[model samples]
Target: MIQMIKKLLVIFLALAITSCKTQKATESKDSSQPNVLVFYVDDLRAELGCYGSETAITPNIDKLASDGVMFNKAYTQQAICAPSRMSTLTGLRPETLGVYSIFTPLRKVHKDVVSMPQLFNENGYKTVSIGKVYHHSSDDKKEWSVYYGKEANTYNDPKNIAIIEQLKKEGKNPKGPAFDSADVSDEAYKDGRAAKYAIETLEKLKDDKFLMFVGLSKPHLPFNAPKKYWDLYDKSKFKIPSRKKPEGVYRLSLTKWGELKGYHGIPKEGDLDDDLTRDLIHGYHASVSYIDAQIGKVMQTLEDLDLRKNTMIVFMSDHGYKIGEYGAWCKHSNMEIDTRVPLIISRETNYKKRKAGKTSDALVENVDIFSTLVDVCDLKFAPVSDGKSLIPVIDNPQQKWDEAAYSVYARGKKIMGVTTTDGNWRYTEWRNSNTHEILGAELYEHKNSLLSYENVSGKGNYKSVEQRMKKLLEIKFPSNGEPFLQNDK
Candidate 1:
């Protein structure tokens, strides 16, 4: 009887071993379904070495551009963190969600929304989010299989931390200086910690089909980075952008850049001095470089683990940032500077080794990211998204694409500004939110320039262009029924 029991145990153990090996092989052999590595940077504008930036030191990002299809005309649906990110993740427009504030809960607004990450999670991909994938760590709890959050405080300097703490204690506004360059390690900051977490997660997910989103919080607010990155540039060589608003732009089109003003050193009203402007610009460049270095580390890991060939990598910013552009300190308007963003997509041997290291001038928006990913992964049964797939453009950058990219801005829930651009002309129309009555309009010709310094909307020569844009806006966002109108796909 004892011998029979031992023999039965041996057989059972062998079966369990075989089952475990079979499961592991199945998980790792899903080569048809490529793993996805997304580097989602915050407040990163199109100012990298690949984007013809003259001064920004972004070697890692530039290399990614070299290995991928770079989109020169990528724009965000909305120029804020939460709304823009939500639009990309859900393939839904901001008007569809009607969420503009960072504090608003996403699930409350769209209960049944299938986010991009959630879809991947449901599709057997190990979806992981590190750092600030969403505006808040708690924003989309159900979307990620694993989430690693960073500390709220972005400052490493003890002085700045003290100032913020004291202000909070006294029932006062708590914000540190606009920029801080501290002599410390990269891990001393939030972006660095995020990079470390990403590297560790990548190693764990190498044997599994996974979707990892690593968010870097830098080049955003309170430009805080290590001293080494700040030392890369000389502040004197940094060119300060125009400090004046567009000549014919309405007062409603611009904000006081209250976001910048909330910092300790920035003034509540009035123009900043040349020294301060240069310092702020310097800090921004440093933060960008810091992020680039971290990206290099993560990319190196992807290569070391032999996962680069099978991973579809995407590098993008949530939205653009305005550093002294048009005297603007932040992104809250429909200005071209605030709307255009940096986007790059790269994969090796995936989808039959399509074109690489190419640049696409085709107009694209944040919503299209979801559509493109779905198409690349061949997720046919996934819920239909609001965006048109950019695979046509990615496969062929010069192909005839969408007419124009659309973006919108809400002014205190009272006024709504809708804008569009067709690579040649940009137009904006402000309207009463509730009544949908057009209040004002501004147009800029971008044939020779991208600066919105002059509004030649009603100019005799551009009358036809202005009229065309108006019609397009109506087609894009109709005044009847649901405001969540989609692009004619």
Candidate 2:
């Protein structure tokens, strides 16, 4: 009878051990999954105070960077608004999607391409978008479970028009000024309305596992902001970007200027008086500050609702804008100022247990955002995505990562190409795939020439370097069954 009792006790102990292991595994899985918030901005660059810009006073964004991981060298797949947004959401290159211009519909390219929001929604998350998440006017309602606001704001809406008319009667033009100024307050802009809506959404969706995309449309164009934000900066202290335009560089035609507005050329020497430049700087700084304030509002709401501990926040721009840099006013160039953007990721408490407040120097692209979200959520995805999951680097910043980012732009009927940091050198080459003609080639030794004014492409000393880069380009993107170049004229 005693021997029988001993065997029964052993069996009971074995069952208890197995039960404990199963409970721990279930807890681990629960802790690993986290809610996601993507705060996407338009036409923003790495010009924040945290990124070493002395002029712009972005306290909130700087705080976000301080509290999270700030990427030093993040890039967009393309510099344009629509294509960049498309690449970011789909994890596919613009070339791969055949979406090179704003005129093309994304659905036309691939009706069945899985977007980031769709992926999240399929995995039991309520995915919602507030304001300009995809290209304005592009039919993308199918991607989100709930989409709020118009393509660019409701300016065209009759109600918004009526509101603007009332403000006009009170001696205020909804459109602030000819140039952007930072002297204005956030209350005067549409982004403020968008921010308020996002906060309300967060408050409403408190109990659901959600993927919230808050898109802020500010500091993009018409550079208009309230007068108080402009007052924050001393106009006398503002200085324009130091890079000069290359002589004999091709200029866009009149038709192109009409499409993109006055962003191609520098004001002829002394054309922009000190006051104008300062005002422009003030407007941009104010717009950034305004956006920063809106972001803070959303963050505070999440914290107040006790969602911060389980939510992962990502802040990034669709692409960098020139803001009068390199003698250019807007983005379209393969230059660093136009391509390099700020990217920050704040890990959730569970993910933070393994990777929190850690900065990774690994080169990342906008396309990677799709895979990163999937991996972070512990969801299974198809085997073929153009981007790699950044979870490994998030856990171990010192891990070796070997990949280079690429950006493409179509001018007329031909596409221009750019490849990111090959070691210390950044190379840009433009070729017409149909005509096989090399339009332009620029090679910058980023270690020595960060501003990229000194092009060493023609210099004999960099011949081997240029050759190697050209070879890499050819290997990565073979001629598309056509000639190497075309007549873009």
lDDT of 2 by residue, 1-489 (tens): 999999999999999987775665455344546889999998898888888788888887887777677777678887778878888888887767766676666776567888887776656677888877887545557777778754332233344456567767887545423343333346456788778888888888888788988888877765556556666777777886654664334343001222124332224343355565566667678778778889989888988999988898899998887655554566776666677788988777555446545566677778888888878877544435788787777667667775555666666575456455654676776777466466777777766433566667767999998887667666556545454232111
Local accuracy of candidate 1 as per-residue lDDT tens digits, 84-136: 89888889888877886666667766777888887776566788888888886
Worst 10 residues of 2 by lDDT: 252-261
Q: What is the lDDT of candidate 1?
A: 0.84
How does residue 439 of candidate 2 score in lDDT?
74
Model 1, stretches more than 4 Å misplaced?
A: 1-31, 165-171, 479-489
C-alpha lDDT score of every prediction, in listed order = 0.84, 0.69
Candidate 2 lands at a TM-score of 0.81
